[model samples]
Target: MTVSVAALIVASPALAQEVQPVPAPEPSQVPLIRMAPAEDEQVEEPQDQGEDGEPASTELPPEPVVAIPQEWAPVPTTPEGRSAYGYYLAGRSALASGDTQQGAVLLQQANRLTPEQPRLREQAFTAAILAGDLKFAAGIVPDAPGVSPTITEAGQLIRGIETYLADGARKANRLLAERPVEMPHDRAATYAQVWIAAEAGDWNRALAAPPADFDPISTLVARSNRARLLEIRRRYEEAENEWKELTAHAVAGSLFRLGYGEFLERRRRGEEALALYTAAIQAGQAEPRIYLAQQRVMNKQRPPATLRYREGVAMSLRTAADQMVAQNANEFAAVYLRLSQQISPNAQTQAYIGQTLINGNLPGAGRAVLAEIPPSEGPLYANARAQRGMSFDKSGMNEEALAEFKLAAEAAPDDAPIVYALANMLIKMERFEEALEILNGPLLNTADQIYEVRFMRGAALEAVGRRAEAEAELNAALALQPNEPSALNYLGYLWVESGERVDEGIALIQRALAADPEDGHYLDSLGWGYFKSGKPEQALEPIEKAVAKEPANAEINDHLGDVYWALGRQKEAGFQWQRVLTLDVDDKRRAEVEAKLKDRLNQLPYDRVAPAVVPATQP
Candidate 1:
C-alpha cells in the first residue's frame, strides 16, 4: 500500500509546528557537500539522445537563473542567492543527519530563493512532497515549470481535489480530465480520473477501453478498480467473477485478497469473508492484516461503506506506490503516499509512509510516524515497534533494536516475521542460544517462512556445536527448498571441512555456485572447499575472485591469505594476513590471522576456519 506522506514528516511524535526552526547562516560560513542519490545508484539522464537513440526531450529546458518565491514557508528577508545557498547547505546537513522535516523546511526556503536551479528546485520539491506537502511542491511549477514536470501533475491532481470539493463532481471531472502527466506517471492520473468520475456517478471511465500505450501494471490496477466499480454498477455477478480472477493472479494473490474479503464483508457475507480469511491463513498467508480482518469479522463488525471518490484516489495512489516501492523508487512512492494521506488519513497509510521513509534512509522521520501508533492498535503497533527496531539496528543501536524487537515479538507471538526479526537480532549480537530458544519456540513451527526457520535453526545449532542436529536441520531445510543455494553452500562448506564427505561437499558448493556465479560468499565457499580438500592450486583462483568481490571482507581476506600460504607464497600470504587485521576482524580471527602472519605455514591448518556464512550469511 502507498503510505500517507508526512504522517511522520515531523522530527518527533509531537506536532510539526512544535519544533523550533533553524535560521539561515552566512553563505561563506556554511560548508555542505552536494547531495547524492541514495545507494549511489546512478540515474542516467537524457543526453543528446534518449535510451532508444531518439532525440532529446521535446520539452523546453530550464531557463537562466531566476529566483522563485516559496509561499509554503517563510523565507528570511536576505539576498535571494545568499539565503538560497545558506538554506540549501543547511538542508543538506539536516538531511544527512536524518532530520527529514527540518531538511524539508530549509530546502523549501532554499527553493524560494533560487527555484531556477533545476537540480536545486527538484531536490526541494522532492523533500516537500515526501513531507506530504504536495500542494507546496505543486506551487513551485507555476513560477518555474522547468524545475519538475512531475510536480506539475501533482498540481493538477490537487487542484482537482479542490474543484471536487468546491464546485461539483462534473466540473471536477472536466478539470481532472486535463491530466498532463506524461508516461510512467500517466497511469496514476488515469486511476485518479477513474475515482473522480465515479463520484460524478459515472462508470464508463472505469470500464473504458485502455489507452493504446497503457502499461500492463496500470491495466491490472484498472481492472482491480473495475471490479469495485462493477459492484457500484449493480453488476454483482460480474464483480464476483472479477474478484476471483484478480485474487488468482500470482502477483495480486494476497494483495487483492484483503480487498475481496472486505468486499464480501461490506455485502454482509460474513461467512464468506471468514472462509476467505481462514483459507488464506491455512495456506500460510498468515500476515497481521489477515489476522486483523479475521478479528473484525468475528466481532460482527461492519466494513466501511463503498469506496468514496477520495478513498478510491488514495487506494490508487497507494497501489501505484506499492509498485514504485517494489522497484526501489521509495522517494517517489513517498510523494504519492503523502498525497493519499492528505485525501484520507488511514493508519495503514501512516505505516506505509513510515516504511517508505525508513527505506529512503529517513529513519528519524519514519520513527516519528511509527511512534504515533499506540499499543492499543495491535498488529499495527507491533509493526511500528518492529520498524523502529530496524531503524535502530541500521544506526548501530544494537541494544535498542533488540529491545524493540522483543516488544514486537511479545505483542505478536504467533506472527512469524516479528519472531524471526527478534531472533535475527539476537543472532547478529552472537547470542546464538537465545536465538535458538526463539527459533525452536512454537511461533514458527507451521509458519509461512518454514524453510528460513529451518535454515536458521541449522546455523544456530552449528554455532553451539550440535553438528548432527544442525546437519539434519540443514537437510530438512534443503528438502523444503531443494534449489536454495544458501543452504546448499553452507552445508556443503561444513561437510567439506569436517572431512566426512569432501567430494560431495565440493559438488554441493559447485551446485550452489550455479545459482549466482558472482556471489562473493558462494565463491568463497567453493574456494575454501577446494583448500580443505588439499587442492590449493584449485582454491587460488576462486579465493582471489572472492577477495575482489568483497574487498573489505575480513573473512574472505583471511581465506585468501590461507590459500596463498598453502600454495607456498609466504610473502603474499603475510601481506593478505596483514590486510585482514586492518579489516573488521573479531578478536579470535585477529589472533588466528596474526599467528599465521608470524609463523609461515609449512602446511594448511587442519582445523577449519568457520566461513562468514555461519553467522553473516544472507539467505
Candidate 2:
C-alpha cells in the first residue's frame, strides 16, 4: 500500500526533467539570490581608440548623496492620541496574525478614541467587514468630511444594505438613489435597483428594458428577477416564456432549472417539475431542495410553497459569489455565500461555503461548516462527511479522516466518489487488502470510475506480489484510458525488471517517455530496461541523467551503481552504492546495497556485459 514513485511522478510532469551531468544540489545549498550592482557605481561605455593609443575619456563626477531626515518625535504629546496609536499598532499586529475578530475590536476601539482620524476609521470599517460584522461596519461609518472616496462609497453601500434589511425595499431604494454610490462598473447599484423595484411590486418598472451598459450577468439577473416576479404573481404563461428564454443561455445554471421546477410544481404540473428536477440533478446540481422536490413529486404530493422573493435574493447573492470566486476574491466570495446560506440554507450553499473556507486556508473552519450539515439532507450529509474527511486528510489528521470517510461510505455505499476516497485513504494507511477488497467488490460495477478503480487495484496487487494480476489490471486501465502514464510506467518497469516481454516493455516505456521526456523516474526505468537487455553502454547516459535529476533517490542510485559496475567503474560503483545506504531506503534494500559494496559485484538475474578490466594504478 506504499504510494509508488510512479504515482508521485505521474502527478507532476516537472519531476521528469532530463538529468544533466552536474548533480542537482539540495534546496538549502543552492544560491538563489543575485547581488545587484551598487547604486552609486556607473558603467563606463567603451570609447574609440585614440591615434596615440590613449584609451578613454576622463572619469565622470561622483553623484552627490542627499541627507535624509531620520529624526522623529520621542513621544506623543496627547494622551488620547497615544492610546489610539497603541491600539492601532496592536490591532494591525493581530490582523497580520489572522485574528480578524480581535483586530476588528481593537481597531474599532482606536477609531472611537480618534474620531477625527479617517485612516483609523477606515481600518476599523474594513476589518469589521472582513470579519463579517456588517452591522458593526455600518455603525462605524465616519461622519467626518474629506474621507477617502473608496471608504465613502463603502460606507454608503453598507448603509444601503442596512436600510434594505431594517426598513424594507422602498426606503433602501430611495436612500441609494439619492446618495448614488458609484461602484466600478456599477454592478452593485444596478442589482440593487432591479431587486428593489421587484420587491416594491412595480413589475412593469422592474421588467422595463435593462440599461445599455449592463453586463451579461446583470442582464441575466434582471431577466431572472422579472421571471421570478411574474411567477410569484401567478402570471404562469408569461413566467414560463421568460424562464424558457433565460434558461436557453448556457450561463443559466442549475438555479434556473430549480426555479422553473418550482414554477411547474406550483401550477400542478408535477411531472414537469419532476423532470426539471431530474435534469438539474443530472447537470451536477447538489442542492437538497431539488432532491426534496423530486421526492414530493414522485410521491404525488404537493411541493412546499415556493419562497420566490427569498429565492431571488439568494440567487443574486450566489451569482455574486460565483463572480467573486472567478476573480479569486475568496474571502469576499465566502461572505456572499454565507449571506446566500442565510436566505436559502441549502446543502449546495453550505458546501460552497465550506470549500471556500478551505481554499482560503481555514480548513478547521471549513470542516466545522461541513460537520453542521444535518442528517435530514441524506445525500448531502454523506457528501459533507466525505468533504470533511478530505479536509482532515489534507491537514494530516489521518485517523480522524479515516473515521469520517468510513461514516460517509456507510451512508452512501454506492457512491463512487465516496468509495474512491475511502479506498484511497485505506491504501495510504497501508491497508492494501481492505483497499483491494473495496475496489474489487462494490467499485467494480461503478461505470463512471472503473478506470481509476482498476488503476488503484493494480497498484495494490503489485504491492502484494501478485504481479500477473497487477499486469492484467494495468492493461485494463490502459484499455480504458490509452497511454495513461502511471499504468504505462508501472507495467513497463515491471515487465523490464521481470525479463518478460522485454521488447514490448521497452516500447511502452519509450511511449511514456515520449509523453513526458523530463520524468526522471521514467528515464530510470528506461535505463534499467536497457541494462537488463545487455546494453549497458546504451544505459549509461540515461542512468547518469536519472541520478543527476534525483540525486538522493536510493532506487535510482542503486540502478546507477549497477550500470557503473557493469561498465567496469568499480570505485564509482562503490560510491553510488554507499550513497544509497545513506538515503532513507528500506531494510532489504540497505542490506542488498551493503552486500554489493562488500562483494564489489553481485550476480544479477538479468543478462549483462562482462565488466571491463581496469589497471591497478586507476584508483
lDDT of 2 at 133: 67
Model 2 global lDDT (CA atoms, 0 to 1): 0.69
Predicted candidate 2 versus true structure: per-residue lDDT over 88-131, tens digit per residue: 67877776655666777887877777665554566687777655
lDDT, each prediction: 0.73, 0.69
Which residue ranges in model 2 land beyond 4 Å of their true spot? 1-131, 140-159, 179-189, 200-205, 233-241, 247-306, 326-329, 344-347, 360-365, 374-377, 392-400, 441-449, 543-554, 568-587, 590-619
Off by over 4 Å in 1: 1-63, 67-85, 111-121, 142-145, 162-174, 177-184, 197-213, 216-304, 322-331, 357-372, 388-403, 444-449, 465-472, 475-484, 495-535, 601-619
Best by lDDT: 1
State the displacement of the C-alpha of residue 386, model 1, in Å, after optimal TM-score superposition.
3.0
Residue pairs in collision within model 2: 16-518, 16-519, 16-520, 17-518
- Residue 21 miss distance in model 2 (angstroms): 48
TM-score winner: 1
Give the per-residue Cα lDDT of candidate 1 at 428.
88
Task: Provide the TM-score for each candidate, comma-separated.
Answer: 0.69, 0.67
Q: For model 1, what is the error of residue 249's alpha carbon versus the real structure, in angstroms, after optimal superposition? A: 11
> Candidate 1, residues 483-504: lDDT per residue as tens digits?
8999999899889879889899
